[model samples]
Target chain A: MPNPRLFSLKSDSIPRATIQRLALYVQVLEDLQREGADVISSESLAKACDVNPSQIRKDLAYFGKFGVRGVGYYIQDLIASLKRCLGIDHTWKTVLVGVGNLGRALLNHKEFKLRGFEVIGAFDCDPFKIGEEVSGLEVMCTKRLMEKSHELGVEIGIITTPPERAQRAANHLVEAGIKGILNFAPARITVPEHVVLEYVDFFHHLYSVAFNITLSQQK
Target chain B: MPNPRLFSLKSDSIPRATIQRLALYVQVLEDLQREGADVISSESLAKACDVNPSQIRKDLAYFGKFGVRGVGYYIQDLIASLKRCLGIDHTWKTVLVGVGNLGRALLNHKEFKLRGFEVIGAFDCDPFKIGEEVSGLEVMCTKRLMEKSHELGVEIGIITTPPERAQRAANHLVEAGIKGILNFAPARITVPEHVVLEYVDFFHHLYSVAFNITLSQQK
Candidate 1:
């Protein structure tokens, strides 16, 4: 059982790992829902997520009391609760900077739209790329980012620029009043305390695989 | 100082969090080396990595002793050691399935090649996609996966197929003698005990951003 008052507290009070797990739970729950599952026991859910059953119970407990004795959690209700906790119940307007191959793939990525992130604009500095239509949006000049971001009330900025240009692109997005940034460039960029930033490191998993394979071979 | 004997132990004895931090340290150290820095104190490295100085020291200590008392660590030597620890000092052959937009972007991504992963083959089931050239590799029928994988000595498989096809792709890769899999589709997959699997969840970061943005707004 969890203290109901914990839900009213600021989000920082909750561990980020817990929040990330909650996001993952939402993903798993949605899958179950698609499979026509009406309910799922904590043990079953934890198995699906590759986590301990008690860990699942503890994470959900941080938000509020969930599930019923012996019966487990109702799939639809649990999904709604987790989504609300993750702030994905409503659509988030986003602007993408850079129109390179990775950028174009992101624009065409249906998962973003399905998950409530709407890429309202795409911007690039290349004159050759400007005015080009990609995934339905006309590629706009990077100079117009601020104006369009404001006009669209964009909340998040996605950076897929080259490493050399990443910092400049982040600067433009912050200047455009974006609240969050997801950087795909293999470069580190600084942002203000108010703005949140996450990196899409493409090599981390590969390194893990390499390390494990090496270890297995050694044994 | 770390016990030198720990370095000879199997990698599982090491915490995954430590391995992940080591991976991050490698990234930060590489950046520093590129910037012409020859030595860096743990404090500086920690600051750049957004981790505590003591945490950096603790994570590095698991492998072996690092850094000098005052002059800190030698950047070039440290990178070489960390890369060797990560098993990325040598090249790992890989193959990519589902030559979609995301797949095409990955083929053009220079980071994989730079980080020692050679994408030796591109594969798809579509007749129109088969025989098409992408990033210097001809798209082959998925049916030939095992033959080509054996010929190329591929160790890793990259899955960028749609959610519905992801499991089948994993099955194909496993049968093709892949030692590890990196799945990009938004689906849960199962692989053999000897084979490792990782997911590129594009939605996790977006969910984090949404949660944080919502929290910030409430504040």
Candidate 2:
């Protein structure tokens, strides 16, 4: 289920960059927590995340104060707050479409469960992959997506189909009432303005790093 | 070989955010190029990229002007400039570590080669996968990473290993003289100050979309 108060706050006030940074903070915080770090100073957090300490302080300030004056922020408390703020404190029922290599990797990825995005259904158009078990879920044909999504209350739709079929997968998800889509397909698929969509383009990261390395070498 | 002229022009003047947006612009431009569009206005590009039109103009301004007063940007001109600016015009010889699902998916991904990133070598610790061929490259044992990387002149190292082995892969790549790294492993591995590192955490995108969908629902 969607968080009731997720948008109750003024989105206009919170910059998109802040939201992105908040996600980064949560990742770094999660790593720290895994390393048995009980408390972390903003300086160390910033360093780990490769951002300025002041930026961390400012981002957290938007959500209210959580850091103690001298001891830094409690790891568990900060994680909890960030999770709640990012709307990941509760489990989100998700479905995965396209069970190709990338799709299977995502299905087998353990990190999603740790963050509460549980893939309850898997679908693909390939007849050979249909009925195959991947990471505990039996793969279903794409035709059943609309029917099964409604039955399972799938809230998040992940499209890992090839570019040719990505739009079809997206339409199926939208017709089934998925609230969010994380598209891994290279094709850009249109979604309703109300439905949240994020593209995980590996090339984007590749180009960014390529450009940064080029710039750094110039120095 | 690294682009020499990449930094002869000012580097400090450009914001990293602009570098990122440049990547986005390139992606959109490439798509348009495939569709056979020769020229595109900033407004249309912004709509496709989901960024403000003004933001697009500001980003392009960093790398010198390419837009005509009334005709918008020449698609071929923008693509060529972006490739040069992002250092993707020349092929980057890259090596991949790990032959797992994600590794396999990345190996099979054609977009990288299209963008001038060629996976010249593949490495994994698993004995069974070491001799296998994936996407025309032989998967070598991790022990051979240093030798193979040097032999192939690998400049970009892609670590798709599990979290536990990610750091080792990074070290191996660094020791082998890789200048940049694209890490798909969940673990955050550190490199020397000079080495460029970019983490492609799928969970980050998952969480971002989840939060966004929650916020959209609340509205």
Candidate 3:
């Protein structure tokens, strides 16, 4: 069982960087578990994650200590603890707005289901796509977003619309009472202070790569 | 014109956080320019980007000083300088290795071309997909990756293959003499020291959102 203190720790007390690292550690640990590794030393985990062992120790310590001295952490225990810490231990009711090529790809993405995000609804504004079947979910008109979201109790909304429509999609999601949004569009959209918004910007990553490649050449 | 000193500086001297901020600033500036804004006060830019004005000034200062006394920055000049600083001033010849749904969406992503990343080739191992048209480019067999990449001078490789196939796709990309890779597959793959690898993990963002929502509920 996860330490009760883990859930009791105020989220504001945790650094955003630590949460990011913890999320990454969960990914690395899942891979390790799938590979049939029962236990992993901090050193090995650090190497796999490309981070210092001490940093890993610090990140995990923010919640509670788990690794035994000299023996390392049990893969199964850490995975469960990290999942709970990340609030992904239970399913999150999710809705995806926009059924474009990108939106279709996201609907078919297996990882979201595997990671506890259940996309219960798919909505679009295109009349042509309104009745289309995509990844087992029938595309519904954007008008149904609020009613369906309320009826289904959607907790997260994903926007994969074009740049021009991103903000509008975000507005609809907010009106639908979504608590969180993950936007994959190139444009930036605003949400209420109470709602959490995150961007999946491919260009940001590409720009970083371009900079690093240029830097490597300079060396 | 950007200062030659910007390119000459050692990449190691600039922190990774600053590079990320610089990329974000470019995006914000581009939006401002699109809206016909020629000049913007640092306060407004900071508010738009949700960062402190001092932080923006500090990030821009890492490359070279630009903002004038009290007048703030000229949007066009800042965008050009930041783009050059981030090594995206010129087109980067790129290739995609997975012709799956995500790969197809990426090929159709207009922002890539608009932001100076030109996809020169799209390769996949699926026999059925080979020779199919995707966003104007024909999908070729993965076997042709090396030859086509070398012949076309490809610099960046995008992997949208399934997790089980991600490593193989990465190996093919590395063998194709690619300098950087933007992997959208939900798996981690290693690259040589000279190559830059970045992951577009939607799960990471979703997990953060989940955590935040859970925290907000507690409040």
Q: Which parts of model 2 have CA positions greater than 4 angstroms off?
A: A6-13, B7-13
TM-score of chain A of 2: 0.93
Instruction: Enumerate the candidates' DockQ scores in order.
Output: 0.49, 0.75, 0.61
TM-score against truth, every candidate: 0.94, 0.96, 0.95
lDDT score for residue B99 of model 1: 94
Compose the digit string of candidate 1's lDDT tens values, residues A1-219: 112221344324666667777888988988899889999999999999988999998888777789999999999999988877777887889999999988998999887877888999999999999999999999999999999988889989999999999999999999999999999898889999999998877687678877777767766
The residue pairs that clash in candidate 3, if any, are none
What RMSD value applies to candidate 2?
Answer: 1.7
Candidate 3's DockQ: 0.61
Candidate 3 per-residue lDDT, tens place, A43-82, comes to 9999999889999988887677778899999999999989
Q: Which model scores highest in lDDT?
A: 3
How are the candidates ranked when ordered by lDDT, highest leading? 3, 1, 2
> What does the lDDT read for residue A161 in candidate 1?
94
- TM for candidate 3 is 0.95
Query: What TM-score does structure 2 among the candidates reach?
Result: 0.96
Tens digits of per-residue lDDT for model 1 on B115-189? 889999999999999999998999999999999998889999999998889999999999999998999888889
DockQ of 1: 0.49
